[model samples]
Target: MSKILDKLKVVELTTFVAAPTTGRMLADWGADVVKVEPLEGDFFRGYGKGLNVPADTGENPLFDMYNSGKKSLALNLKTEEGMAVLHDLLKDADVFITNNRTKALKKMGIDYDSLKQKHPRLIYATITGFGDKGPLADAPGFDTVAFWGSSGALVDLSIETGNSYPLNTPAAVGDVASGTNLFGAIMAALYARELNGKGDKVTVSLYGSAVWSMSFMNVIAQEKYGYKYPKKRYEVNPTAAPYRTKDNEWIMLTILDHDRYFPSLCEIIGRPELSRDPKFIDKIALLNMDNRKELMQILEDAFNKKDAHEWHLLLTQKDIVHDILKHFKDISTSEQAMANNYMSEFAFPNGQKAMLAKPSLQSDNLGEIENFRGPYLGEQSISVLDRLSYSKAKIEELLSKGIIKQ
Candidate 1:
């Protein structure tokens, strides 16, 4: 079957998670994405080494997850010949994606303004740590600092743990989210271009994405609002909290309508009488500090009497909105994930196999998206240059001069 983006050509000049993630998604949707790396390749190629995963075995799952289904063109952008090669590729390209800082992009003469003059129909998508006009625009930004730390997510989430030390965010969580947002913006630009025959420059920042992710809390967190952060578990609504089970596993409940579910929850926890008690009868009375504390204690004790799986079964039976917390290892083999094609196994060139996640979006037209390993450094350099109409002698000259790598 023809893929949704079969005819789209994307040139990706990026490293790390965010921009690469956008390129990966486009590739998954069937775009011919060419990843342009430096002669040393994307720095992320060595990321698996730091995690104790060997990179030499062609089994760098971390890199592959964000780079799969794309061709590689390792070039020396510092050289005029290499820059000429890149511009040639961009001449007929539909999109250009990058996460390089604006200063560096301008220095390399690939910034939006420079490219728009040449490739006016190209969709230029960029991801930054902060917005381009901010004081920190030129400053280095990573998911850890820009998304979680500066965006108030770190402090707000840490408050529930009852500690001054901030919690570390999971790896690339913000980058992936920001990348998804960039993908949406690129799709919108593509749609707009179809109507007006003009492309656009689209940008998404990690900090901005983080803030938008927390928009619900952000709006309520104003000084004029009664809501406040740093709330202890006991101080929160009992029906909407995490509880530890007898097996030491955690389960979270999300019963937004307390009045509707409080009685059922009380019955499930073997505290049916609490449903009748005026102090904890309704959501309003549960607002009382003492009443809330007592109910929390009762719920905690009740949850500890059953294993997480037992609670899961009970919650399913009662139709309560809840789920047992799962570790990363659990997700790989999750029945639901496997059933829904959220994860699948891929075999590396060396015959090593690993399960990897599919792109979040699913389409009936493009069922079961195929997974391919990421290209090696400059793996497609000759092929890409050949397709760009470079003569074999010129390609050899460029390679011999170290302007391109293979």
Candidate 2:
């Protein structure tokens, strides 16, 4: 079946995760996304090397995961000629995506104001470290600083102990989340354009996205509802925390409705007698701070008797809300991830098959996806320029002038 965005054309002038992720999602939905890069290619092309993937590796799966199924056009945007080429490409494009710093964008004459006036029908989307008008608007930030640190997520995630440091999350968690937010904004803007015959600018910041993700805690604190961040052992719902099993693996439970599930949970752990005890008999009794501490120790002692896999099976059978805390290695082969289309097998240029993360959406009518590896730098420059009606001699002249690459 035809993909959703088959008629759309996107010019992606983005680097790293946040904005590229939006472009990747659009490409997956059949948009003709042309990734514009500098002569050196996106900086992320070298990211996997820093992660210890060998330099000799034929393909960077990390880059491919976010950039596959897109064409590339390398240009020297620092030059006036190169900027002119970009304007030509954007003339008929449906969307322009970028995450460049605001000052640099204005200086380069490609900020939303500049482009929206020239291309009134173009959807101009931007991602930034902070909002455009903030004091830190021009500050450079990555997932670690903007999303986690500045968003106050680090404070909430930190342990209560004085010496404890803020917990570090998996890489690009915030960037990926922010990308999804931008994707939604772009789709909404597109719908609005459909109604009004005009496109609008869309902007999302990593800091704003991170703060939104942790809004629950912030709302509770702001409302003065007497909610306090809890230590692991003193969590409001002792049942909803991680416990180590006999095999040293951790299993987490999330039975929010303690009143409904406490009896079965007690029976599952071979502690049926505790279900009727005075301190643990009801949700109200267990909700008391002292009783919660007592129940936590009891559950810990019982959980330690069984391996995490055993609890996984037992909890599943009993319909308890729980999961084995998965290690990153487990993700590639996870049955659930595969079934949900969160990951899939793809072949690399070296003819080796590997699992890669997939776009979140899955539809039966997406049709047969093309087999594509990430583009080499400016790999499609000649073809893209040809589409713009450049003569072969002119294309060659531009290549010689260091204005374009193919």
lDDT per residue as tens, model 2, 1-406 = 5689999999999999989999988898899999999998898988989888622237678888888789999999999999989999999799999999989999999998887888999999999998888689899989899888876667665657757777776689889999889999999999999999998999999999988998887787664686676355566567788889999999999887776788889999888888788988777786688988899999989999999988998999878998889889899999998887788888877777778887775667785444357777898999999999999998999999999988
Error in Å for residue 377 of model 1:
0.4
Off by over 4 Å in 2: 54-57, 230-232, 367-371
lDDT of 2 at 95: 95
| Residue pairs with backbone overlap in model 1 | none
Q: Give the per-residue lDDT digits (tens) of candidate 1, residues 1-68.
A: 78999999999999999999999999999999999999999999989888898676468888898998
Best by lDDT: 1
Give the Cα error of residue 375 in candidate 2, in Å.
Answer: 1.0
Query: After superposition on all CA atoms, how large is the RMSD of candidate 1?
Result: 1.3
Query: TM-scores for all candidates?
Result: 0.97, 0.95
| Cα lDDT, model 2, residue 226 | 68
Candidate lDDT (C-alpha), each: 0.90, 0.86
